[model samples]
Structures are given as structure tokens and as C-alpha cells.
Target: MRVMVFVKATEDSEKGFAPTPETMAMMQAMGKYNDELRNAGILLTADGLKPSSEGKRIAFDGPGRRVIDGPFAETRELVAGFWLWEVKDMDEAVAWVKRCPNPMPGPSEIEIRPLYEMADWQE
Candidate 1:
């Protein structure tokens, strides 16, 4: 199964500042985990995004497009990073998540959603 894992943003992440030494250490730990996953052949891709302040958005309504600048509000809804993994099943993915170090300083969130390929789509 292929899944997309999203690491949600926090207030600190939205500030668009560099990570502290502790944060860097955590990131290094995360890198180790990523390496393990990659060595196990489960990790396909992973990336950490810059702060939301450097981002932009486009709202669409009936063919109308409105561009909005970033530093967007609602930190809870923003994504700070992501990982794409291919595992045997949800259980395996869950196991991997259980082993991951906390990605944020305080409480944070990671959401996992399976991706659908064309073969599974029905018209």
C-alpha cells in the first residue's frame, strides 16, 4: 500500500525561523528513522517544507481563481512536512509511525492516508 503521511504545522513552524539545536537533534533522529525505512525499502519519498509564510494559495470557485499570500492562519491546518511510503498494509505503516520520534517540540499531529492508483478507480 502507498500512503502519504503529513506532519502538521505548529506555531513555531509558522514563524519561518530556523530550527533550534534541540529541534535539529530531533531532525537528525528523524533522519535516522527515515534511513531505516529507506533501508527497509518502505520509504519512497519524504520532505520537510519551509514555513507557511513563504507559501501561497489559490482558491477556486466555478472557474474563478483567487490567489492568497501566505503566513496563513490556522496553524493546526497547515502541513510542515510529508512522507510517502509503501508498506504491506496499514498495520505495517502504523508500526512505523509508532517508532518515529516526535516531530515537533510539543504536541503535534501526523495524518496518514492511502493513495489510490488508476487501477482502483471506477467510473
Candidate 2:
């Protein structure tokens, strides 16, 4: 099964604050964790995102599209990064996430969601 792991953004991340020394150390730790995942052939790809201030959004209303600029008002709703992993099951993905280093200062969160299989569309 494939899963998408979301690294939730904090206020600091939305504000475009650079990682602190401690946060940097945590990132280094995460690097080692990523290496482990890579060696296990579970990590397909992963990347961190720039702050919303440098991002843009396209809104769709029927056939009309509107371009909206950031930084968006909701920091809590923004995603900071993501990881794509191919694992045996949700259980395996959860185990991997449990080993991740704290990616930010203060409270942080990560969400694991399963991806739909290609077969699901064949119905």
C-alpha cells in the first residue's frame, strides 16, 4: 500500500521563520531516519515546502478560476512537508511515523493517510 504522510505546519513555519539550532538538530535526526526508510525501500519521495507567503492558490468556481495569493490566513491548516511511502499496510506506515524526529519547536503533528489503489478506479 502507498501512504502520504503529512507534516503539519506550525505558526513559525507559516511565518517563514528559519529553523532554530535545536530544530536543525532535529532535522539532522530526521535525515538519519529518512536514511533508514530509504534503506528499507519504503520511502518513495519526500520534500518540505516553502512558506505560504511565497505560495499561491488557484480557486475554481464552476468554469471560472480565480488566482489567490498567499500568505493564507490559516497557519494551522497549512502543510509543511510530505512523505510518500510504500509499505505493507497502515500498520507499517504508522510504525515508521512513530520514529520521526520532531520537525518543529513546541507542539507538532504528523498525519498518515492511505492512498487509493489504481484498481479502485476500474469499477
Candidate 3:
């Protein structure tokens, strides 16, 4: 099974500020965890995103579209980063997430969702 692990954004992440010592430590720990995942052959890809200020959004309605610039609202709903992993099942993914270091200096969240394969689309 394949899963996408989302690192949800926090207020600090949305601020796009410089990294502090605590954040640096967290990054180091995350690096080690990523290495473990890679060595175990479960990590397919992973990367952190820049703050939303540098991003854009395209909204679609019917046949119309609107371009919205970021620095979007709702910090908690923003995504800070992600990882794609191949695991035996959701349980394995949950186990790995449980072992991960804190992705933020303060309280944060990681969301795991399974990807739909072609087989799932067939009746």
C-alpha cells in the first residue's frame, strides 16, 4: 500500500520566519527518522514546502477560474510538507508515524491517507 503523510502547518510555519534552535533540533531528528525510513526501503519521497506566501491557488467553479495569491488564511489547514511511503498496510504507516519526532517546535499534527490505486477504480 502507498500512503501520503502530510505535515500540517502551524502558526510559526505560516510566519515564514527563520529557524530557531528548537526547530533546528527538530529538523535534525526528522532527518534521522527519514534516514531510517529510507534504509528500511519504505520511503518513496519526502520534502518540505516553503511558506504559503510564496505559493498561489487556483479556484475553479463551473467553467470559470480565479487565481488567488497566498499568505492564505487558516494556518492549521495549510500543509507544510509531505512524504510518500510504501507500507504493508495502514497499521504499518501508523506505527512509523508514531515513531516520528515532532515535526514542529510546538504542537503539530501529521495526517496519513492511503492512495487509491488503479485496482480500486475497477468494479
Which candidate leads in TM-score? 3
Instruction: Give candidate 1 misplaced runs (Cα > 4 Å).
Output: none
Q: Model 1 compared with the native: what TM-score?
A: 0.93
Question: Over 4 Å off in model 3, which ranges?
Answer: none
Instruction: Please give the CA lDDT of all the candidate structures.
Output: 0.91, 0.90, 0.94
Q: What is candidate 1's CA lDDT for residue 102?
A: 95
Candidate 3 vs. true structure, TM-score = 0.95
lDDT of 1 by residue, 7-123 (tens): 999997777647789888998999999999999999999999999889899999998999999889889999999999999888898889989999888999988899996768877
Give per-model TM-scores: 0.93, 0.93, 0.95
Candidate 3 lDDT for residue 69: 95
Top candidate on lDDT is 3
Between candidates 1 and 2, the one scoring higher on lDDT is 1
